[model samples]
Target: MFGRPQLVFLLLLLVAGLAWLRLPGDEQRVRTALIMGTLVEIRLAGDPQQFNPAIDAAFAEMSRVEKLFSSQLAESDVSQLSFSTEPFQVTEESAALLQRGRQIARQSDGAFDMSLGALKQLWGVETENPQVPSAEQLQQALAGVGPEALQIEGRTVSKSNPHLQIDLGGIAKGYAVDRALEILRRAGVTSAAVNAGGDIGLLGSREDGKPWRIGIQHPRKQDELLTTLILTDRAVVTSGDYERFFEKDGVRYHHIFDPRSGYPARDCQSVTVVAADVASADALATAAFVLGPQQGLQLLEQLPQVEGLLVAADGTLHRTSGLAALEP
Candidate 1:
C-alpha cells in the first residue's frame, strides 16, 4: 500500500539536519497538516510569509475533503453510505472519485475494486489486534465485492446489494494530493510537491528549476534503491505489501486485498506507477500489483499516459520501454 522504509527515511531526512541546509533563495519553510484520514507532515518551501497563507488554505481545503472521503470516521459520507439502504448523494468531487473508481474496476478486471470495505473490516488491518478473518466472514465479504453491485447516478451512489460497501483507500489520498496541487498552483506556487504517504505529485521543478529526483526503493533490500527517476509535474505512487501486515502461522498477510478472494494478492512484490496525475497513478498502482509483473507491464504499455515500474516477488525489475530510458 506504501513504501514504508522509504517514507520513514524521508521523514527522518526532513528533520535530521536537512532542514537547516537550504539553498541561497530557498529559505521559505511552512508546515501544514497532510490529510490521509489522519494528519501527517505537509512541508512547503518558498518565501515564508506569503507562502504560509497559501499553504494553510491548501491544507484546510484538503482537510475538508478528508472528512468527505474517510471511511474510518463514522460520520463521513463514505461511512454513512456504507450503512444506508437508500442511494447516497454526494458532491461533485466525491461523485468524480466514485466514477474514477468504477472506471478502474472495469479496466483492471475487478483487480482494483472499490467495494472492499467489508473485507477490510474483517481483516482489521487498522486495528490493534489484526488477524485472519474467519471463513464465514470472508465468504460474506466476498459476496459483497463484485463491481456490478455498485451504481453511480449523477451525484448519487447506489448499490444493487444493500450490504455492499465502498472503500477509497487505494485512491483517496492521491486524489487529495491532486486537489491540493490545484489549489497551490492557483495560489502561484509553481515549484512544489505533494506527498501523501508515498504517492507524490510534483509541480514544475525544484527551487533550482531542476527536475525532482526520486528513488524507487528496492523491495528486498531496506537501504538500496532499485532505480531513480526525474519527475516534473507528474505523480509517483507505489502499491506494495511492506506497508502493513501480520503473520498468521507462517504466512504473511498484508493490507492490500484482492476482491476476488477477499485476501491479499501475492504475485508481485510491488508496483510503482507514474502518471500525469496522482489519482490515476494511485488507482493504476493498485491495479498493477493485482495484475502481477508481466501483465502489469503490458497494461502500462497500453495506457498512453501511464508508465509503471514493477518489482516481482523474485526480486526482478520490470518496466515499460519509456521508463527504462528514464530510470537511473
Candidate 2:
C-alpha cells in the first residue's frame, strides 16, 4: 500500500522541499504525523492560531479512522471481522468502505480483490522477509480468494468461508484522507491539502492564489520526477512497483498482486489516478496498474470524473485524454 523509506523521501521532497507558492498572508500551518503506517501531512492557509487547532482536529480524525480500519490492529473492526465465524456487525464507516471495495472489485472484473488477505500472508509481502510461496501454498491461499466469499448486508458482514479475510491497505488510507478533509472543512478551512504518503486530496488554491503544483515521482528513477501537475480541489494518487518489493535472483517481487495470477502485477510499472475523491483515485490507481495500459485507460474513460496515467513495463507512458490536458 505504501513504499517504505523511498516513499517517505519522495513525499518530503515534494511536500516540504519543493516550493509551490508562497505569498504574503498568514504563515502556512503545517502538521505531519505518522499514521496509517505512513506520514500524513496537513497544510492550511489561514490564521495560524485558528488553523492550528483545526490541524490538530484533523490529525485526531485520521487517528480515529486508523484505529477503526487498520488490519494490523487487534481491536480494529477489520481484525474482529476477520476472526469472526458468525456475522460480524461493523461500524458505519467500515461497512461503507467494505461495500465500496466490493463495488470496485466487481467493476475491475476481480483485477483488484479485497479477499486476498490469505494470499498476502502466504507471500509475506508485508514482512521484511518476503518469500515466494510454493505452488501448493499458492493454491491453498487462492481457495479463500474471491469477492463472492465475503457478504455484506447493511452494517453486518459475513464470509461463507471462515478463512476468507479482508485487508483494506489499498483503499483505507485514501478514505482516511477524505475523512480528514471533512474535519478540516467543518473547521472552516476552505483552502487546504491533506497528503497521506502519495495519496493527496486538495481544496482551493495555495496562499499565492495559484493552483497547487504536485510532482509525480519517476517509477524507475530515484529522486527524479516524471512530470508535474497543477491542480485544485482534486485528489491524486499513485501506486507503483517501486513502493514495496523484494528481489530474488535479480527478479523483483512487488506488493501489487494480480488476483488471477497470485503474483505481482507486471502490466504497468506504475499508475497515477486523479479524481474528485481520494478513495476513488487510490482504488482506481491500483486497479489500473493490474489492468495494464490499454484496459486501464479504457476503464478511466468510462469513469466520468476520473483520469489516469500509466507507465508500462516497456517504459512507454499512457494517459487518459483528460489527464493529458492537465499535464504541466
Candidate 3:
C-alpha cells in the first residue's frame, strides 16, 4: 500500500483536476477559501466582462466578517469579547451581531444561549471521536451556560465569569450569508444566492423572474428530498444531528446541545427555519432543535415572520402550521 503522505498527495491532485473541470471556459469561475471556512464559489452567469470588481470585493468583505465572528480563532474579536472582563469593544457591524444574538436568546427563553461554549468544548463535536462527558464534567460546564451570564451593552459584551466562552459557529454562518446578500445587492447583482455550508440566503428572483427552488435534505434517506422550498428574497437555515454524529453502542450523540444539562439534545433529528433574514433563522434552528418537535412548532406559531420544519428522532417530519402558505 502507498504511504499516507502519498495517498494525500494523490487526493489533492484528483480534487484539483475536478475543480478545474468544473469551471466553465470564457467565464472565470473562482472557488477560493474564505475566512478559514468553506470554499466560496463566484460564478458569472452572463458575459464575463459584465462582472465588476465590486463582486470580488464583496467576497473579501465576507471573509473579514467571518474572522471577526469566529470563535475557533483565538485572536478573533468574538473570542476576546466573550472573555473580556471589561466591556468588550466592538465595531458597528459586530455590535449588531451581538445584539441580534441577545434578542434570539431572549425570544427562545434561554434555549439559544451564546454562552454554551464551555459545554461545547467538553463534547468536542467537530472532533473525530465525540463522547458523552461525565456528569461531573457536564455539571461544571452547565454552570457557565445561560442568558443571565451574558451582559450586552450596545456593541460591548461582558461575561459575568471567566469560564464562559462564546461560540457563534451555530449562527455565524447564516449571519454571514445575509451579510453577503447585502453586499451583492449593493453591487447591483439582482439575482443571487449565497450557500455558506448549506445555510442559504436567496437574493432577488432568478434572471427569468422565477423563484429559486431549494431542496430540503431528507433526514433518513440519503438520496431523497423531504420537500422543495420556493424562495424569493428569503433566508433558510437548517441544523440537524443527521449531518454529523458519533454512534456509540447504538446511541448517537450529535452537536446540538441542551444548555440545561450540557448534553446533546435527545430531541429532534433536524430543524429548518425560513425567515426574512438569516440571523433569526440561524438562532431559531438551534432553539427548535433543543425544544424538540412539539414545543418547537408551538414556538414557531408565536413568531409571525418565522416558519419551521422539524424532523423528529424517529424520522417523522412536522412543520409549523404556517408552512403551507410558504410552500411553492
Candidate 4:
C-alpha cells in the first residue's frame, strides 16, 4: 500500500484548500470529508434525488476500506495480519486486494510493494525525527518484505516470515476511490468524480457534457501547475519526491520508497499515470517513480489503457506519446 497526497482539480481550480468552484442549484452537489487522512471530495451531477444517498454510500465505503486496510490502525484487518503468528482469515474483499497487491508487486518487480511496514519504521518518514537509517538498519528493514513475504489463498493470508511487516497504504486510497466510484455507478449516477487527496477516479463526464478537467501539480513548486488534463471515465494518480520529505544535507528524502532498497526512490521527481482505474494508476505512479523514466515509460507503453508522464531527477521530462493529445 502507498501513501500519497491529493490532486488539484476541476476547470483549473486549485483544490489544495478544498476550494472547488461551487455550483449553486439543484443540478450539482459536492461533499467533502476527512477520510484516510486526506480531504476527500465527491462531486456528483445528474439526478438530484440520488446525490446525497450516493455520496453517503461512497463515503461509507471509503471509511470501511480505511478501517480494514490502514497500517497505522492497531485493529485494522491488515494490521492484525501483520502481527499475527498464525494464518489470518480475512474478508473476501481483503483477499482480493491482497491478491491484487501481489499482482502489482510482481508486475513492478517489487517497486510497488505491500510489505513495507518495517521499512517505513526505519525511515521514520511520518515521524518528527526522520533520519537516514544505517546500511544495517536498511537491510534489516528489507527482511521478509515484498511480494514473497505475503501469501494469500482465497480468504486466508499468511506471512512466510514473521519479520514481514505489511502495509497497504500504497493501494488502499486508490482502491477506495475505485470502490467509491463503483458504488456511485451502481446507484445509477450519470456523472461523478471522486478526488481523494490527488488520486482521482471519474464516471461519465462533467455536468456540461465535457470531459473532466484535472491538474497535475508541479512537484518542486507545489503551488504551481504542471499541466491540465482533459479526461472522463478514467482515473489518474501522481507520486512525487516533493511530498512528505525532509531535507538533510541538501538532499530531500521523501515518503515514497523502493521496497527493494528500503530507501526513497530517486529516479523521478514526479510521475503521473492515467488509467481506467485509480488502483492501477496509483500502483503505476509509484512503480514509475522507482523504475526511473525510461523503464517506467516502457512499462506504461506495454500496458493498454495506461499513459504516464515522468519528471526525471535531472529535470528532464518524459511521457507517453499519446499523453500530448489529452492536454490543450
Candidate 5:
C-alpha cells in the first residue's frame, strides 16, 4: 500500500530544474534496502556525513519492528499471539498499535480488521501457492475475523477466541515508515522522505520548498499514472486489488479482504488515502476499499484530516472532499 515514490522523487527534480538543483553540500542521499519484507527507500537532503548515520539508525529501528511483528520469527510475540489463550504481554509499542487498529476497526464498522489471520491464511494470497477457499472454509474463518475478539489491557493482549489470528500487515508497514522518519528528524535532517514498499511518509519538502508531487498508480494499468497529489509533511498510501491477486475461472481475487464476508473486497479496484500519518492512511485506504465508493468516500469525508480517492469496480474514480489531484 504506497504512492509511487520514485515517480515523485524524479518528477520533483525535473519539475524544479538545475537552477534550484542539488544546492551543493545539502545534496540528497538516497539509500534502499530490503527491510520489513519490502524495499525501503530513504531520501535525506543534508550533509551525507551526518544523515548517513541517521539512515543506519532508521533502518535499525525498522528492522527491529519487522522482527517484532513478523509471524515467522518464533521469538516474536505475534508468533504466539494467535494461538495463545493466556493473557499475552507484548511490547508497549505493539499494544499501542493494536489499540489504534481496534479503534479504526470500530470506526469503520469492521471495514478494516487486524484479526484476519485466519482469512488471510485460508486464501494464502502472499504465499507461493494461493487459492480460493471453499464456502464452508470461508465461513469458518469469518468467525475469527472480528476485532471485538481482541482485548488489550495495557501491554497484555488476549483474545476471547483462542483460535483468533491477528495480523497487521499494511498498518505495521506504515508504522515502521513513521518510526523511520522519527529517527531521521531527531538527527536534525532538514528534508527527507521514506518509502516503505508503497506506503510513504515525508518530513520536509524537496530543495525547492514545493510540496512533493506523488503520482497514484492507475489500478488497472501498470506503469501508468492515474493522478498526482502535491503533499508535504504528510503520508500517502494506496491499497489496490492489483497489488496482489490471483485469477481463477476469470474471477480476480485479491489480498484486501472484507471481514464481513471473508472474501476479497471487490467494491473497488483501488483506494488511496492521504493523512497526517501513514499508519492511519494505510489502514483507512483498506477500510475505504472494503466500504466501496459511496460509503467509502463518506467514511473518508467524516474523518478529520483524512482524504481518499477510490477507483470503483466499474473503473470510475471517486474522491473525498478537499483532496486536490493534478492531472496525469
Candidate 6:
C-alpha cells in the first residue's frame, strides 16, 4: 500500500529508526513486525506485564484485519469481490471500508479511488518485477478502474463491469492501525503508538505526559526530515512518490496513480495528512497527493479537523493554514 515492496521496507526502517529519547521515568516497550506487506511497530509506555498482552492482542487484531482486506490473499474479501462478478457477501468491516472509499472518491472528485486493482496489476507496482504497460494494455486496465463501477448493497458488493477489480490499498492500513489501537486500549494500554509503515496512530501521552513527536520523512531526501509534529490521540498518514518508484529514461514512475490518466500522478512528490482518525488521514493523503499543492490545500481547507503538508514536485513544501503553525 505504501508503494513498492522495497520502498515500504525503507519507510518502515525510517520510522522505526527514529531515536526515542525517553525520560528517566519513561518505561517503553516496543515490538516490530512485517505485516500486511509493511512494517508494523507497537510502542507502549507502561509496565512490561501490562504491555505484553496488549501488544500481542494488537498484533493479532492487525493480522485478522489483513486477512480480511489484503488484496494479495486470494481468500480476502477484497479478492473475492474482485474475482467474482456476482454479488459477494462480505463482513461488516469490509462493507464499511468500501463505503468509506466511495465517500472519499466522491469527495475528492475521483482523485482517490479504491477500484484501481486492475491498473495496479497492469503496472505491477506491487510485484517484484514492475514494468510500464503498453498504451493498449493501460487503456484496457483503465477501463475497469473507477469507484462508480462498484455497487454496494448492505454487506454485499458487486462490480457493474465484470473485469473491474477492487483494491483497498489506499485506505486499509489506516483502518488496520485504528483497530490495533482499539485492541490495545481495550487491553488496558493507556499510552501506545502504532506505526504501520508510515500511517501512524497514537493514544494518550508519553510516560512523561509530553506529546509524541512524529517526524515526517523528507520527500526526496532519505536521511532528512521535512518536519516533526507534536501529536496525541491523533493520526498522521503520509503518501509519497519517493516511497516506491522506478526511473525509466529519466522519468520516475511511482505507485500513486491517477485514475484518469492511468499513470502516476505528477502533481506532488509526497503528501502527509493529519486527522482525528487514521483512515481519513491515509485516504486524504493519497487524494491530496494527486490533487497537488493548490487544489490539495483547497481540499484540506474544506475538510474540518484535517490538516495537510504537501511536498511539491520541485521539492518545495506547502502546508495547510493550521499545519504551518505547528511546524517549528
Most accurate candidate by lDDT? 6
Against the hidden true structure, what lDDT does model 2 obtain?
A: 0.86
By summed lDDT, the worst window of 10 consecutive residues in model 2 runs over: 17-26
TM-score of 3: 0.86
RMSD values for the candidates in order, in angstroms, are 9.5, 10.0, 9.5, 10.2, 8.7, 10.7
lDDT of 4 by residue, 213-232 (tens): 89999888858988999998
lDDT of 5 by residue, 1-328 (tens): 2279887887777767653454553334788889977899998776667789999999999998888888667777787797688889999999999999998888898899988888899999988889999999998887756758788999999887788887888588998899999998898976888999889998988856877888999998898988898888989999999988888889988999988888898899999999989999999999999999999999999999988889999999997877864333
Which stretches of candidate 4 lie above 4 Å from their native place? 1-28, 47-49
Worst 10 residues of 5 by lDDT: 19-28
| TM accuracy, model 5 | 0.90
If both were scored by TM-score, which would come out higher, candidate 3 or candidate 5? 5
Compared with the true structure, what per-residue lDDT tens digits does model 2 show for residues 41-62? 8888877778888888888999
Q: Any runs in candidate 1 off by more than 4 Å, and if so which?
A: 1-34, 37-45
Q: lDDT per residue, candidate 1, 1-328, as tens digits?
A: 3379898877887875565664543435535464664444444556667777877777877787788889978888888888899898878778889898888778888888888888888898778888798888899887857666678889988877788777889888888888888888998998888777788888888877888888887777789887898888899998888877888899989988877777888988889999999988998899889888888788877888788899888878888878876665
Estimate the lDDT of model 5. Answer: 0.86
Clashing pairs in 1: none
Point out the worst 10-residue segment of candidate 3 by lDDT. 25-34
lDDT per residue, candidate 6, 73-148, as tens digits? 9999999988986888999889998998898888888999998899999888667888888989888888856667
